[model samples]
Target: MSQNGAGVDLETSLGYLLKEASSALRAAMEEVLRPLGMSVTHYSCLELLAQRPGLSNSELARGAFVTRQSMNVLLQALERDGYVTRPAKAPVGKALPTRLTPSGRRSLGAATAAVRSVEVRMLAGMTETEQAGAFRILRSMIRSLNDGDGNA
Candidate 1:
């Protein structure tokens, strides 16, 4: 409820709607990824490595929206499973740069297709113009929210 006498209306709350949409998208992605034995974060890490090889664990964690510890754990499992590889020692700094193995690339290919299908389905009803407009709107909203100072 809001501070007013009346409570906040869920039906008309854009934040609530956006969160619901995000949850639905995640569920759909998980459904498709489950058969491939990958979670959304797992797939995200692989995809990030494929696009930008040699990303550090911290970078991968930020890209995948996971914690550093969580990313380190996943990287360990991926190395064990032959999906990714990292140097025995960091070449320069404390950051162990990670990269995708051949096996990881193959796995990412399948996951990419599955994730793309989910996105296509989500945008099925929207025309190209509407899709572009929605993209711009969403980006603007994100920028607006992120522009705030930490004092808030």
Candidate 2:
């Protein structure tokens, strides 16, 4: 924000706004997850794996919006923690699919519930239709950003 007309400056770009929102939401999530002995990244990955079991490393990376190297490291750590297990489907280098162990599935269920609880609390004042509208607006923003044409 600045002394300008709209009170938004370069620092208030849409990317910055989204990042700030993410930070706030993540803070709330971390508060809820701390008692469960899980970090936000761990919880997110577990949830994603639960939704798409046996997703390949590359697919998981893209879905997680991270690099393959980072995904591999996270997978290794989760495997060590018995949260996820990777059975060798083929040669490791090309495309190795990973599956969630039973423990991983359980963790995902718990984390998903916890996240939804937090989200509901955060959206308490909003009606269902308002919630839907907010989500739709966010999705449209993301689509427009990714499209880069701004035609819509």
| Best candidate, TM-score | 1
Candidates' TM-scores?
0.91, 0.82
Q: Give the root-mean-square deviation of each candidate in angstroms.
A: 2.5, 3.5
> Candidate 1 residues 34-149, lDDT tens each?
99999999999999999999999999999998999999999999999999999999999799988898999999999999999999999999999999999999999988888895
lDDT of 2 by residue, 21-104 (tens): 789899999998998888887787887888888787778888878888888888889989898877755555668777898888
Where in model 2 is the C-alpha error above 4 Å?
5-16, 89-93, 149-152
Q: Pick the candidate with the highest lDDT.
A: 1
Residue 104, candidate 1: Cα error in Å is 0.7
Off by over 4 Å in 1: 1-5, 149-152
- For model 2 the local lDDT of residue 12 reads 60
